[model samples]
Target chain A: MSAQTATIRGWGFLAPAVLWTLAFFIVPFVVMGAMSLATLDGRTLVWGLSLDNYRELAGQAYLARAIAVSLEITLTVTLVSVLLAYPLAWIIAYRVPPRWQRLVLLLAILPFWTSYVVRSYAWLLVLARDGVVNQTLMGLGLIAEPLTLANTRFATVTGFVHFFVMLLTLTIYANLVQLSPNYRKAAMDLGANAFQTFRHVILPLTLPGIMTGAFLTFVLCIGDYITPQILGGNTELTVPQVIMVQLGRRADFPLAAALAIVLMGIVTLAYLAMARWLRLDRL
Target chain B: MPWAYALALFGFIYLPVATLVLFSFQNGSLPVPPFNGPSLRWYGDVLGDDRLVEALLNSLMVALGSSAIAVALGFSAAYALARHVLPASALWRALLIAPLTVSYLIVGLGLLIVVQRLGLGLSLWTAGIGHVVINLPIAFAIIYASMGAQQQNAERAARDLGADEARVVLLVTVPMLAPAILAAFFLSVTLSWDEFIIAFLLTRFDVTLPVEIWSMLRSGLSPRLNAIGSLVFLVSVSAVLLLELTVFRKRRR
Candidate 1:
């Protein structure tokens, strides 16, 4: 085929996807960006360059608090999930029998197939006042009364951590299994103890993978609505919850768009910070 | 010691699900502790509820429909980029994959704005569109990664033997890449099926299972939620195991 024909055919194949993305994804994003700068004049949208929504986000104590709360919860979830999942991935990678490793990993992430909304609701029940955690504690004489485990930041964090631990385990285990046994052998030959080898050799090699997983955890956790809404019990609002309220109750599209833009900004900052280690295409 | 830790971690991971499934068989209304008779009452209730059943069917349609569109678009894009030399191909690839980085909430909210502005009412079709937007990048990336020199050679052979480009793609390229394509389609379906925020934001009266489940949760807590959740879990895991047994296992041999 001629170069012209080849290019034309290539574009013919590409146009459907490109047009769909541009129309639905790119166009909507640009419109949302514009909507963020527009104002609501008594329920009528006034479209123009105005920063009123952003200013409102800064001035309102609750709105400002939502941003702080989202950051705190997301950071905590990311750190805790990484700390927890890394050890699990290591155990599964090095400790499990080769024949059983796949099964073990699959079992680890099996809960992920459950409905996401249902999973959050499941957490709510598990942590309720008369829930299993409390019942088990009382059964074992660990406490006199049930602790307030549900509808709190702890519940929200627990729910987020549960989902992310599974995700990070998968990503980190993939990274771990890719390393040849030769690396560990070489480190041991250099008179490195197991801990020393892990610290100096394995740790650095897997840092990129860890970062990638942690970044994913951060993005998903920060943007998540269902976990916090169901598990949080309105104790505190995350940014997504706040955005939902804006759209659902107030019909405040401009403000919600502004909040979404803020969310995009935060995710962008995270991406930049972890850009060196991220293998987004690999996912 | 690592085994003990693994056991404990696995316990933590499975506790909620075990509770959810266990209470789904509870004879009582609440899905909490104080175990009662092992019963199928809640499961019966969930299946009998018309709204929940309707939402389940809606979720299935959206999952299958959106995944089909996403896979088709993704496959063509992957094929074009893999085969032909388009100018600024890297930029095009980046654009196609860009949505993977954005949050689902943001994507849904963005589309909500455009849909409302354009006076287009929200429905399952709109929700399907949103699902396609999110799943397309995933399908594209997976298929693109699996496109190899072996398929390229086969396509060339087909072309050399007096076959047209379309025949080469349909007969040679697709069959060779069937595993990747199927994997991408199934993955897309799995994601679209369980998606919450996008469906919640995009749809109106006709909602998906996750959205319906959310409302069920809001109205009150019951074992009914547990029953439906367990059913969804059962369906998803069955699909996954079937794929593992049939597609992946066959490929490995």
Candidate 2:
């Protein structure tokens, strides 16, 4: 085929995806950015360059509190999930028999196949006043009365952590299994104890994997609406919940778009911070 | 000690699901403790709910439709980029894969703004579009990664034997990359099926199962929710296990 024909054919194949992304993804993003700057005047959308929505985000206590709550919950989820998942991954990688490792990992992430919405609702029942956690505690004479585990930040964090621990375990396990046994052997030959070998050798090698998983956990946790909404019980709202409220109750597109932009900004910062270790294409 | 900790962590992971499935069979209305007779009453209730049934079908259609579009578009893009030399190919690849990093809420909100501005109404089709947008990158990456020298050699052989470019792609490249394509499609279906925020934001009266389940949740808790949730879990896990035993296992061999 001629160069011209090849070029034409290549572009013919590429045009549909490019155009779809540009029309749906890129164009919508640009429009949302513009919408964020446009103000609402008594239920009228005035489209132009203005920072009224952003200013409102800053001025409103609930809105600012939502941002704080989202960050706090997301960070806690990411940190706790990583701390928990790393050990699980390590155990599965090193302790489990080779034939059974895959099954173990699959079992760990099996619940991930469950509907995302249903999983949160499941958490609600598990943490409800008369639910298993409280019932088990009372059955064991651990408490006099049922505790309010549902409808709180604790519930929201628990839900988020549950999902992320599964995710991080997968990523961290992939990373762990890739390491050569020679690395550990070499470290031990250098007179490193098991703990010292892990600290200096294994941990450093897996930092990229840990960061990648943590970043994913951060983005998903912060942007998530269902878990916090169902499990959080409205005591405190996250940014996504606040964004949904603006869209749902008031039809406040400008403010919601502004909140979405803030969300994008935070995710961007996280990407930049983890850009060195992020293998997005690999995922 | 490691085994003990693993057992504890596994217990933590499965607790909610065990509770959900167990209460799905509860004889009473509430899906709480004080276990009662295991009955299929809630399952009967969930299946009998016309709205939930409709939403389940809608979810299936959207998942299948969106995943098909995503896979087709992704395959062609991957083939073009892999075979032909396009200028600034890296930039195009980056642009295609950019959506993978963004949050679903932002993606849905962005599309919602644009749709409202364009004076367009939201529907399952719009939600399918959103799913395609989010899933295309994944499809692309998976297929692109699997496009290797082995496939390249087969395509060249086909072309050498008087096969047209279309024939080479349709007969040679596709068959060679069937595993990757199938994997991508199933992954996309699973994601779009369970997706909440995008479908919630993009659809109207014709909502998907997740949205319907969300509304059911907001109305109040019941064994019905547990039943539906368990049903979804059972179907999804069975599909996953089937794929694992069939496609992925064969691929490994």
Candidate 3:
């Protein structure tokens, strides 16, 4: 084939993907940015370059509170999931025999395949007033009455942490297994205690993995609607829940798009902060 | 101590699924509380609900339809990029893969804005388009990663034998990459099948199973919800096991 023909064929192959991305992804993103600036006058969308929606975000108590709630929930889920997952990944990587590590890791993430919506609902059932957690506590004489576990921030956090812990475990485990044993031995030989070895050597070495996992946890948790929707019980709403309300109830596309843009901004900031260690294709 | 901690974590991980499956057999009206007689009543109810059944079919159609397009586009793109030199290929690849980092909610919202602006009515087709949008990058990545020099060599041999580009791609390239292609399709199906936000935002009366299940959750608590949840769990687990046996097991062997 001629070089010219090969280039044409290459363009042929690239055209579909390029067009699809441009149409559905890039074009829609651009339109959404434009839509965010427009205002709603009595259910009619007014297309204009105005910051009314953003200004509303600043003025409205609930909108600002939603942002705070989203941030607090996201940070809590990210930190807690990482804390829980690191130890689990550590144990799986070092304590479990190599032969069983794959099986162990697979088992750990099996629930990942389940419908995410159903999983959140399942957490609701498990944390309900008469549910297993409270029932077990009361059965063991640990409490005089059933605690308010469901439909609260605690429930929402628990649900988010559960999902993210599984995710963090996978990322952190991949990092842990890739570490050379020589590093640990080298540190110990240099008279570092076990805690010192971990704190000084292993922790620093694995910070990239931790940050990557935490950043992912941040992105996913903050953007998630299902967990908080099912588990949060309208006691308070996250940004996603508020966004949904704007779309579902009031048909407020302008404000919702603004919220979505704010969300994108937060995720962009997170990506920039962790850009060095982000191996997205690897995930 | 490590074993003990591992056991506790495992319990945490499996608790919801176990409870879901258990309550699916609860013979009671509500999904919560003390266990009752084991029964298939709710499962029967899930099968009986016409809307639920229709949603399941909708989910299947969307999953398969979107995945087929995603894989086809992704494969061609992978072949082109892998075989022929293209200018700014790295930039193109980044543009293609940019959606992977963005949240599903944002993607759905963006599509929703565009659709409404265009005055296009929401339907399962729009939902399928959204699924394709998300799954295309994944399909591309998987197929692209697997397109090594070996495939290129085989393609060259085919071309040298006078096999046209179309014939070479259809017969030689696709067959060689069958496993990866099938894996991407199956994975995409699984993702779209269980996907909620995109389908929820993009569709109208016709909804996917996840959207259907969301409605169920919102309306009331029922053993039927448990049944449907367990049913989805069963179907997904079966697909996963099948993939493990066919794909991963073959690779290992």
True contacts kept of each: 0.82, 0.87, 0.79
TM-score of chain B of 2: 0.99
Candidate 3 residue-wise lDDT, A40-74, digit = tens: 99978789999999999999999999999999999
- After the best TM-score superposition of candidate 3, give how far the Cα of residue B215 lies from its true spot, in angstroms: 0.9
Q: Tens-digit lDDT track for model 1 on A1-283?
A: 8999999999999889989999999999999999999999898999999999999999999999999999999999999999999999999999999999999999999998888998998898899999999999999999998999999999999999999999999999999999999999999999999999999999999998999899999999999999999999798999999999999999999999999999999999999999998886666
Q: Give stretches of model 2 more than 4 Å off.
A: none
CAPRI-style class, candidate 2: high
Poorest stretch of ten by lDDT in candidate 2 chain A: A274-283
Question: What lDDT would each prediction earn against the true structure?
Answer: 0.93, 0.93, 0.92
TM-score of chain A of each: 0.98, 0.98, 0.97
Per-residue lDDT for B1-253 in model 3, tens only? 8888889998999999998889999988877768896999888888999999999999999999999999999998898898889999998899889898889999999999889878999999999999999999999999999998898889999999999999999999999988899999999999999999999999998999999999888776778888898889889989998998898787677
Each model's DockQ score: 0.88, 0.90, 0.82
Q: Candidate 1 DockQ score? A: 0.88
lDDT of 2 by residue, B132-191 (tens): 999999999999999999889988899889999889999999999999999999999999
Model 3 stretches astray by more than 4 angstroms:
none
